[model samples]
Target: MTTSTKQRPEPMSVRRRTPAWAKAVIALVAVLAVLFAGLRLSVLPGLRDLFGMDTHDRSGPVLLRSIQDMSRYEAASGTFQVVVDLERDSKYLPSAIRGTRTLYVGAGTVDAYVDLGRVGRQDVTVDADRTSATLRLPHAALGKPTLDPDRSYAVSKQRGLLDRIGDLFSDNPNSERAVQKLAVRHIGEAAKESELTARAETNTTAMLDGLLKSLGFKEVKVSYGT
Candidate 1:
């Protein structure tokens, strides 16, 4: 106890600190790794899309037969313009409650033609002297009407309250198709009433007369089949 007990101070512990540059290097490496991973994911998908590898083709080829032996000669043409009003409703009591209406304006042309193939060799008579000829042509027929897509358009449409709800549950009526059909029918009727057949016959006669006259025939006669 008398011996001045000098308490020996315990050796101070020393903690080593990492350098600032090393911390910065570690942070930079981590950022580079993240960027590299992002680039890999984005570039692979981009390349696939660019090369169309990610897309699927769901359509196949369509083939059609070639049309042959069709000799079409237009003899007359008629243009008709009309407005069609189409109305449809569910049958029975529902018709009064649920009705639909559509109006459309359509313009179209009807062409008339004569089939030359129907003419037989006997139908054409050439005099022995080759100075006169008589040609018999077939009757005129109406071709399919061609609608003007640009001019044809729906003018108005109306759907009743109940009809609107019914459309949600049932298939909707095709107003455009109905209107188109009506247009065709109306145009055809008008064309027939306009004497398109008579015009076609007249035109055909003139055409044949001119052609035969050009062939050194002094007299040419053209007649149409009944």
Candidate 2:
């Protein structure tokens, strides 16, 4: 009995082929991982430029408006800062129900100028020898307070329940008009109280003295009028 035992068929080794989409997806994931690592480590300096992350100013062209000749001499400038705490409340309601409060910090500049255009021939008196001179000038006047938007900002804002609710439905709900106006007023008052006009007068006097001395005037008298 030559019993040739049936040899068990060797099990075929099954190999599964990866799909094209799967290979592509794996490559993309690997590339994204590398990019994220580079970004986190800040190793790629040109990435921000490639991504266009820089600020672009798309403002329109600045139109030329009417121009006026400036004949006033800006002798002195004063910088002023003020804190404005403004609040509004409804008369019939409680503070928590109908009220708004804002704390704003404002910075501005005030210029003190002398109007040279107002000087007339009669205001300038020359002595007989033409060596002495007297000039009657107008007192230095303060210009309008120019608020600096870059330096001015709102520090805090608190709104009541009604005010908060109304803001959702209103356009420009976060308008700071009232606070800005108050800030400007306070800055103006502070500028008025400062010695900017006095400083301007001193500078103007020095300037005129130098100018007159160079013009061969031995005695230069500058008197200011109201």
Candidate 3:
């Protein structure tokens, strides 16, 4: 008994300490929350400005190129998109050391046209009464691929250590000329393989037929030259 024996030892006061990682996570979350609030409130200059995102266009004034009269009728046009992947690799080095790769998304339009200026007196045949007419027209031709700057862009690019270092001294380091040329070539090839010309011929024929009928021709026969 001895004075109710030694007082029961007070339960050791246990204080759990938060792990370092957990504390760090909490701090990061708090910072992010504050940033989000600032962004939402428009009190920040935005992430882009904060990260020094900027662009300066020092392009020269556009010169007026020579103008030429055009007499071609664009009968059909086709919109096209292509992905160009171009790469260059060093013969004795790995990609990470001396290689470069680019991915570009190109958008353009190809026009199918009939050159009305090419048609002459010999190309048209008319009956004595002028009630019937026949037109021999040149085959539809494809126009140059016109790339859309607004819709065409470079998706991604990767360069090796040496290549990146070299770019620092290059005049046009981020040039997309190669990929743009490839894209144009691919688009031209695709247009050639498509039925765009055939469609153009059909449309031109319809247009001619309607016009001839309105002009008092009872019969209109349209044919294409080789």
Candidate 4:
């Protein structure tokens, strides 16, 4: 009887290195993640966005700042007409959601003009040196509690009245409308970026509050379309 000596199986040697394809995939994934991180954290914050910094919340302070900045440019002798159109977004229907304004600032940046739907339209002209400012408004679109230079520069009712007054004089408020286009074409340029867009839309709302203190407007009437 030949006793069969059981030969112990040689210990198996296993290689621990990761698969080549898996290594390549891991490297690629790592590179992409680094690039994405750089963009999200470093590259985007200071990129001079026309619409101001990105806001997670749409209805935030960016709109107000844009308007204020435009006004500052006006007060500084920059001739430009900023058109704040409350144009309806065709996609967003059934509700009047105030969309971006198209700012049409003129050359020299001295004059600025914009249309604020409920507040009415305005045309502002400031001297090159920022000394004097002239605003033209149609007498028809005036709203209540308007500034009354005719009444008194120290207007009792001009409290919180700066939003709609920039348009001075009895001139053609929307003259650009008749000759085949709005006045924007003749001005500096249309604000194509989101930054100026916000300003154009909200300029009326911000300026009106401040103008009340300066007696900047002569009259303001609501519900009038002119």
User: How does residue 17 of candidate 1 score in lDDT?
Assistant: 92
Query: What are the lDDT scores of the predictions, listed in order?
Result: 0.82, 0.89, 0.91, 0.37
lDDT of 2 at 24: 100
Report how far residue 157 has shifted in candidate 4, in Å: 43
Q: Looking at candidate 2, what is the lDDT of residue 35?
A: 44
Better of 2 and 4 by lDDT: 2
Residue 136 local lDDT, model 1: 86
Best by lDDT: 3
Considering only N, C-alpha and C atoms within 3 Å, which residue pairs clash in candidate 2?
A: none
Per-residue lDDT tens digits of candidate 2, residues 123-190?
99999998999999999999999899999999998887778768868898889999888888888888
Model 4 Cα RMSD, 1 decimal? 22.9
lDDT tens digits, residue span 1-226, model 3: 4565567777998999999999999998787556434454244557555676468999999999999999998999999999999999999999988999999999999999999999999999999999999999999999999899999999999988778768768999889999999999999999999999999999999999999999999999999996
- 1-226 per-residue lDDT for model 4 (tens digits): 6898999999999979999999999998787556434344335565445445655756745454343322122211222333333232335432222222233322213223343322323555555655455555322211111111222121111111111122224275333232213333433233332244334324544565356426654443222134
**lDDT agreement of model 2 with the native:** 0.89
lDDT of 3: 0.91
Off by over 4 Å in 2: 1-58
**Candidate 2 C-alpha error for residue 49, in Å:** 16
Segments of candidate 1 deviating more than 4 angstroms: 1-62, 90-97, 166-175
